[model samples]
Target: MFWKDKYEVGVELIDNQHKELFNRVEDFLKVIRSTTLGEKKAQKVNETLEFMKAYVVEHFRDEEEYQLKIGYPDYEKHKQIHDNMVSFVLEVSEEYEKSGYNDALIQKFAGRLLTWLINHVAAEDQKIADYAAKREGI
Candidate 1:
């Protein structure tokens, strides 16, 4: 439900993937915010984290490919942003596991994830659409 029409980048594939990411994150938030705790909560959080580990990489790869296809001038910069986010996610996942799936750690991670997702989709990704529109005269 955090996803909005304005966040779309006008690329069907990317838009769909973005929506999936939003949905996943929203589900993640719900799981973490629930009254459940201990093993049940950790199990749900781990599942969502694992899914994000794979899906985020896949989505970034696809998005980068699209950027290359369009010859987006800021492809390198965009990729760096993606790379940084991927690193952060991985790092946090590791920390969470090492901490025995600490609740506070995940709560912090969820907040950061939400902020990053919104900013990336709403602002950063919009630049891509704007460039494509200008390039293709859309």
Candidate 2:
């Protein structure tokens, strides 16, 4: 939900991308938590969703490139994680549209996104950083 200093992997570009991701996700959560629920709020939610779709793809590409550059041992596994997330986002976006932008669906998506992002950054990503540190002396 929030970016912490401890999350830094000591790779400047990747760390900055992670921070940007955290910031965007935090803002998305804040918008979802807002009490105003109507055309205005729905517009904001749609905007955030759009941003997520594009930004997530870009971030994942950069992360994957970083992994490839470093010859990360678990690069395949990490890429699978990214692929799964992309698929989930696409599926959710379709469902959101089919449901006429239902508030409940959006809320569920937000909750899942929050948990997923935290776990990915705090746990999964840390593994990559640990390996890079140990193998490459980063």
Candidate 3:
């Protein structure tokens, strides 16, 4: 349960997506760390990776839309961050496939993913919430 109430961006859609991301990444970590057989673990990892690719894109799209709606001052910078992450995920997935679903690569990817999610939700996304709050005088 890496997700915390404090990490919420005060937007229902984005907050829910954040929670889902946390859950997915946490599941990924558990799978990689488990005593599951190598084949099963690799299969699960591949599934998770595919899900993340699609879900992350959808979530970012929605979040960016919200930013645009509110005229968030950092929209461009924030979107660039999202774009970079998407590219990273795509690049990693490609590498993971090329490596024949190597365990070491996925293990490393999971760690980085968790760290990025936590930082983005708790810090970067918080800025959006704060800006929205101030604008609304909430």
Q: Pick the candidate with the highest TM-score.
A: 3
- Return the clash pairs for model 2, or none: none
Order the candidates by TM-score, highest first.
3, 1, 2
lDDT of 3 by residue, 15-117 (tens): 9999999988888788789885677788888888899899999999999999999889999999999999999899889998888777678877888899899
Better of 1 and 3 by TM-score: 3
Q: Between prediction 1 and prediction 2, which has the larger lDDT?
A: 1
Query: What's the TM-score of each model vs. the native?
Result: 0.94, 0.90, 0.95
User: Compared to the true structure, candidate 1 yields what TM-score?
Assistant: 0.94
As a whole number from 0 to 100, the lDDT of residue 107 in candidate 2 is 84
User: How far out, in Å, is residue 72 in model 1?
Assistant: 0.5
If candidate 3 were superposed on the true structure by all CA atoms, what would the RMSD be? Answer: 1.2
Clashes of each: 0, 0, 0
Per-residue alpha-carbon lDDT of candidate 1 for residues 28-120, written as tens digits (9 for 90 to 100): 888888885557778877887898899999999999999899989999999999999999889988987888778788888899999999999
The window of 10 residues in a row where model 1 has the poorest summed lDDT is 36-45
CA lDDT of each prediction against the hidden true structure: 0.90, 0.83, 0.89
For candidate 2, the lDDT comes to 0.83
